[model samples]
Target: MKYKWKPVLAAMLASFCLFSSPLTALATDNTVSTIEDEMVHNTEGAAEAGSAETQTGESETPVQADEEPGWPSGPSIVAESGIVMEVSTGTILYSKNMHAQYYPASITKIMTALLAMENCELDEQVTVPHEAVYMEDKGSHIALDEGEVLSVEDCLYGMMLASANDAAYALAIHIGGTIEKFAEMMNERARELGCEDSNFVNPHGLPDERHVSSAYDMALITREALKHEIFRTVSKTVYYEIQPTDKQPDLIPMSNHHKMICSGKYHYDGVFAGKTGYTVVAKNTLVTCAARNDMELICVTMKTEGRQVYVDTATLFDFCFDNFKKVDIGSSGTEGEEIEVSVKEGDSPEKTEKIPFRISEDGYVVLPSQAEFSDLKPLLLLNADRGPEVTGAVLEYLLGTRTVGQAVIALPESMIVKPEPETVQNETESEPEQEKEKEGKGFRWWYIPLGILGALAAAGAGFLIVRRQIWKYRWRKNRKRRRSGRH
Candidate 1:
């Protein structure tokens, strides 16, 4: 009984399903997408807003000799090596001899403060070594006696605010185990931040001929340092007091030497953090970080005169902040959809393989206020062309010669379009099949149409025969009536 009813139940269920409304999950649209659309938006929200102002490999607008708008030359100052870099994008806004090597003076403490914060806890106590107590202290010092102890937080505040060499050395020794080992750690860190032309032999920026760095290198270090919460807090501080320690009694008052942060005559509106340095040989060196209009700027000036370093930094910051604005590339046209570029097929030109990619919305280029998005150039780095900086970035955006930002392009291996293999047939071996195909073409389905026409004709003939028979019968009856009348 169950077997017999199963088929009937199945048939009824099938009928219900066939007549029911369609599922809502199958909806879709067919709008054409741009290159920005070719790359699918990743979960990290990496996509441009909508930059239709680009060609396949270049900017949309053509640049000519006379019409090309170059990057602005910031106000000139006495600093021999100076640079203004945007923190987020790592864009070099205004640069003059930025690569030249110069003594970094006391600004080298920034690295020491950063490493201490990273390696030790804020409340962790750091012991002052015997060397810190009696070591050459002609430079700035908080006068730490031997066996004196301070927390990592206190040391950072003292090192950054007072530009204390003793505090820097103590933190370095505590973190790296020795001053020489700490210097090695510093060099290693500098290399990690892409500082190509820098070497550190001491924690303090004392005039070691070998201990030297470039403006570019220092800015790079500063950018890396600002990532730490403690570094950021200490760098911007104007004044801090070190309370009585176990080895010392009186309070140690410390004040920041940075004119901008100290509210000196050279104070600028957005200057939050800075480190000042001066040695007879190095002259005056300064590193400043400022923020305005949602953008952070790091200005490094090496080998400048007394007050001119402050003047140079402020000028450069004002120039960059006033003239430049950030613009997104490969932004959101339609999110989650990829724009594909079909460049090549394996070995044959006949077929093509399209690779799907998306430009990271996180990537942006700083452009001049008057410059249009079309003026920015996009360089897509594929396979072998990718470098360390572009490891996760598929595109590098440039404003003239300077790199403004990079695009986080997602190129999934699963999404690669490969050419389908072709199946070839030998003409001789398939001759019989070819002949059969030819014969089959000739054998058209004429029977269906002809049979339909023949059935219709037969029906019409039958109707005519019946009508004739009826008419004959009627004629005979009429003749009989006439005969009867004549009789």
Candidate 2:
């Protein structure tokens, strides 16, 4: 009976494994398939929503989702691509497929606006070209006529507030000579702004498969754009009334599509500037900057369904603002402690000298609000090959794998002594003696002069003794000769 029970138990265990193995595999496959489906569905839904909104010229209010647990313990977001970064430190606080490239849609105007501000003055007049007004019928526009006249300032407002496609083209052509060249400039500027996965095919983000940018890249562009006063002013404007232009003579009332900035539907108190973008292919994209308690943050969300773009961005901001605090990692000179570096071939190679370095700029690290100086682990990495005279970033302070801040480890101007020209060796010295002399302790400066003086003294003494001997020989010879003469 015991043997029969053992067999039965073994048979049951085998049956369980046989059934469970396929079930486990099926569950994993379903999970992956579901994620893929969700991403595709989100993209398709965003495209439909954007198209519907553009057709109706109506902005949708964002529906807020239930708040999850605080960051690091929160539920996953629905955005296909998103990122939250510190404006000052460029430290990434939260990211989901941040580097994955997505179409930027109308957010492309940010770069166009940036180039306009840089290349044209606010008062500069620009003529709307035929190409500017000839966009697809379905695209957003402020109804600029061909050859219409507007100031650069007005164009920016029209483009940003209303996401006007014609205004963007006019500004681009005016600043960059042609749409092609303007796109080139946009790409160059994107590279300069540290955007890696981005390409600009046109000034207005219409759907070109070639025009793409990543969430991180868009954030980088937004960061640079925020630096300009005009950009900030234009982006934050809710309703800008464009004065009647020469072609139409009717005043166009433009409203910002960014509900966060215009309608204040999902507005957070600290939101200063935001840009909204949408396209059938690119889906929905958004970039916003917010500041709280002196910590500025930039958030970008892409390929989200309906109002989820706004909801996702708001959630990211909330998570970051609630959980993270800007900690002054302290500036380079604040510590007042100089780093002692062993400089090879330095003036005092035997003894290390203290290099006074200041953090290139005041650095701030974003950490959990509860994080303290004790929790921060700083590693000082010195460039062993760096010259003593070169004053630049010599050591970087890192927290874990991330570089929290960098200290410009520069040798003081006074300490940067041109290494004494290597003592050129006299070719006359033997190799062994040269090696001995190189040891520095082997010979003093007085040794050569002392040796010369010793040789001169010895020669003089020898000359004097030889002269005395010659005189003695001459005297003896004269005496012998005189005695011989007497005999």
Give a tens-digit lDDT track for model 1, residues 442-467. Answer: 85689889999999999999999999
How many clashes in each structure?
A: 15, 1
Best by lDDT: 2
What is model 1's C-alpha RMSD?
A: 34.7
What lDDT is reached at residue 216 by model 2? 91
Q: Which 10-residue span in candidate 1 carries the lowest summed lDDT?
A: 29-38
Task: List candidate 1 stretches off by more than 4 Å.
Answer: 1-69, 329-361, 382-393, 412-487
| Cα displacement (Å) at residue 110, model 2 | 1.2
lDDT of 2 at 137: 44
